[model samples]
Target: MVGLYMVPPDNAVVLSVDEKTQMQALDRTQPLLPMRPGQIARRTHDYTRHGTASLYAAFDVATGKVLGSVTQQHRGADFVRFLEKIDRTLPRRRALHLVLDNSSTHKTPEVTAWLAAHPRFTLHFTPTSASWLNAVEGWFAQLERRAVRRGSFTSVSDLRSELRRFIAAHNKYAAKPFVWTQPADVILDSVARASRAMRINSAGH
Candidate 1:
C-alpha cells in the first residue's frame, strides 16, 4: 500500500525488495559513438549476447542505501539467500518492513519459514501488475540507464562484476531516495482502465 511507502522515517525500516532477472551481457557490434555538443550518443542496433545474470536487491526507503546480491539463476533458494544477506547486513535492532510484488518466490515455504522465524521482518505485497509501487524499481531504472543499457561486456562474469561495482558506487555516492508521488486512487484508476482495455481486446478476438 502507498501508506507503507510513506511510513515515517523513525518507524520500522522500509525496504523495497525485488529481483531484476535475466539481464543480458550485450556487446554492440561496433563501438558506441560518444556524445558531443549538438549530437547525441549512438550505438549499433545489433549485439552479441554473452549470457544473463539476475540481481536481487533491497532498497532502503528512508536511507537510499541498497543491499544487493547477484545470482546465476533466479530461484526461491536464491531469494532466501538474499533475504539472509539482508538480515545480516542491517542492524539487528532495527525492524525491517519490505515492500514486494506478488511473486510466488516471495511466498515459498523457505521464505515463509524465514519470515516466521524472524519476527522483526514484515512484508507488504503490491497488487498484481502494480510493482511500480515498489521503490526498488526506480533504483533499477537508474541501473538500466546508467550501466546496463549502453554497457559492453564480453561475458556474464564481466557483466556481473560491473553490476556489483555499480551497486557499491550507488550506496557510496548515489543515495537518491525515491518519493512516491502518485495517489492510490490514481494508480487504481489506471489499472482499471488497462484491465478494461485488455478485456475488450480479448473479447474481440
Candidate 2:
C-alpha cells in the first residue's frame, strides 16, 4: 500500500475506495447549548433516530479530492453505480487503480462483471484486517470527526445535504495530494515482526 501511494502507475489514477455504512440521521432530543467564552457547546444525550444512510466514497490518492454518493441500500448494485460515477468523471485514456478492502459488495458478480467490461479499472485489495493501509480510511475518519460527529440532523435528507456540503467544502479548501512518508521496507519489517510474534503466541497457547 505504501509503495503504491509513493509510486503509482504512470498515466493511471490511484484511488482508495470504501463505504461508510449505516450512518444514522439522529435528531437530538433537546436543543443544543451554544458555546460561550467560558463554556463549550453541549448536546442532549438522547436522540431520535430519523433513518440511516450509506456513503460510498472514493479518495483520489494523487489529489485529496473525494467522490461520494449517498444511498439507502449498500448492495452490490449501489457499489456498481458508485463505480460508474467514478468512471464517468475520469478521462477515458487514464486507467483507474482502486485500492479497496475485501468487502463482498466489491467482489459480487455484478461488480466483477462491470469491472470486466471496463478494463480500464483495476482493483487492488488490501490484506485482511489491514484496512488502515488504505488512505481513504483516514479521510473517512476526518469526515466523521469534522462533519458527522456532534451534528444534529432532523431527517435523512438533512444528513445527506450536510455530507454533500462537507465534501464540496473539502474539495474547494482542503484538497491536496496525500504523501506517504514511511518507507515500504520499514512497514514490511514491522508487519513481519508482528506476524512472528502472533505465531509464537499461538504456538505457546
Candidate 3:
C-alpha cells in the first residue's frame, strides 16, 4: 500500500476512500468571545447537539481533490451510493483503484455486487489497525481541525452544508496530494520498536 501511494498503477486513478462518521452538529451554550489584542478567542465548553452526520470521501491521489457525500447513516447502502458518485465523477476510460479500511459496511453484499458490476473499479485494503496509510485520513483530520471543531451548527443540515462548503474550498484552494515520506524500511523499523516497547510495558504491568 505504501508502494501504491508512491507509484500508482499505470493509466489508473488511485483514491483513498474512507468515512468520517458521527460528526455531531453542536451549538455552544453561549456566543463565542471575540479575540482582542490581549485576549484569545474563547468558546463555551457546553454545547447542544442538533444531530449527527457521516461523511464519505474519496481523496484523489494524483490531484488531491476530494469528492464527498454526507449521509445520515454509515450503512453499506450509503457506501455504495458514494461509490456510485465516484464512478459518475471520474472519466469512464480510467481504471479506479480505491484504498480502504476493513469496515463491515464496505464489504457488505450490496457493495460486493456494485463492485462486480463496475469492472473498472478495484479495492485495496490497508493492513489492520493501520489507517495512517490511507491518504484520505489526513484530509479528514484537516477538515476536523480547520472546519468542524469551531463550527456552530443549528441543525444537521447546517453541518452538512458546512462540510460541502469546506470540501469545495479545499478542492479550489488547499487541495494537494498527500506525500508519504518515510521509506518502507524506516516505517517497519519504527513499528517493530513500538511493538517491542508495548510488549515490555505489558510485561512490567
Candidate 4:
C-alpha cells in the first residue's frame, strides 16, 4: 500500500517516529498562574528531582494520533519498544510506512535486521538535517509547546501521566491533515538558487 496519507481512505498508515531527550522530572504541587495584571507569578527554581526520561514518540500523520513511551534511555531497544507500540496502534491487517530520521538508534544492526525480517513494515528516512520533513516533528513541537516546555512533574510517573493525559485530550478532538502550502517547483527553485550561489562562491576560492 503506497500513497498512504494522500490516496485512499485508511489503506495505509504513515508513522513518523522520533525521540526527545533529557526530560527532567520536576515536582511542583501548586497550580500554574493565570494571566493577570501586575502578576509577577510564581515558579519553583528548584523542583524535587525524580530523575529523567527520554520520550520516544510515534505520530500517525493521517489520523493526527500519537503514541509515546518514556524511558531513561533513548537507544535501539527503546526504539523497538516504540515500534511495538506503533504496531498496537493500527490494526493487524493494514500496512505501516514509517518516516524517521537517521538517528544512530534507528540504524543499529538489530533494527535493520528486524526490518529485514518484517517485509510488511517499511521505513523511510528523512533527508539528513531535514527532520522538519517528518510530520511528527510538528507534533513534537506542539507537545513541547503545550505539555512539556516550562512544565513540571513530581516524578517520572507523573511525567508519564501528564503525557498520557495530553494524548487523551488531544485524541478527543484534534485531527487535521497538514497542507502543503509551498508547491514542489517553488521549493526546487529555492534549492537551485542556493546551489548556484554556493558554486559561485566556491569558484572564487
Give the alpha carbon lDDT tens digit for every residue of 65-145 in model 3.
999999999999999999999999999999999999989999999999999999999999866556677889989989998
Q: Please tell me which predicted candidate would have the highest lDDT against the true structure.
A: 3
lDDT of 3: 0.89
All models: lDDT? 0.86, 0.88, 0.89, 0.73
Please write out the lDDT profile of model 1 over residues 56-88, one tens digit for every residue: 999988879888999998788999899899889
Model 4: CA > 4 A from native: 1-10, 29-34, 37-44, 187-205
Q: Give the worst 10-residue stretch by lDDT in candidate 4.
A: 1-10
Between which residue pairs do clashes occur in model 4? 26-153, 27-154
TM-score for each predicted model, relative to the true structure: 0.85, 0.88, 0.88, 0.78
Give residue 184's lDDT in candidate 4 (0 to 100).
61
Over the stretch 96-119, how does candidate 2's per-residue lDDT look in tens digits?
999998899999999999999999
Model 1 lDDT-worst window of ten: 2-11
Of candidates 4 and 3, the better by TM-score: 3
Q: After superposition, how far is residue 98 of candidate 1 from its true place, in Å?
A: 0.5
Per-residue lDDT of model 4, residues 1-205, tens digit only: 1234345245667777788888777776556667588886556455577877778877777667777787889888778777777777678788888878878999888788777876668888765545566777787788787887668887888887777787778777785665445666665565466557757777998
Cα RMSD for candidates in order: 3.5, 2.9, 3.7, 4.5
Best by TM-score: 2
Deviation from native of the Cα of residue 101 in model 2, angstroms: 0.4
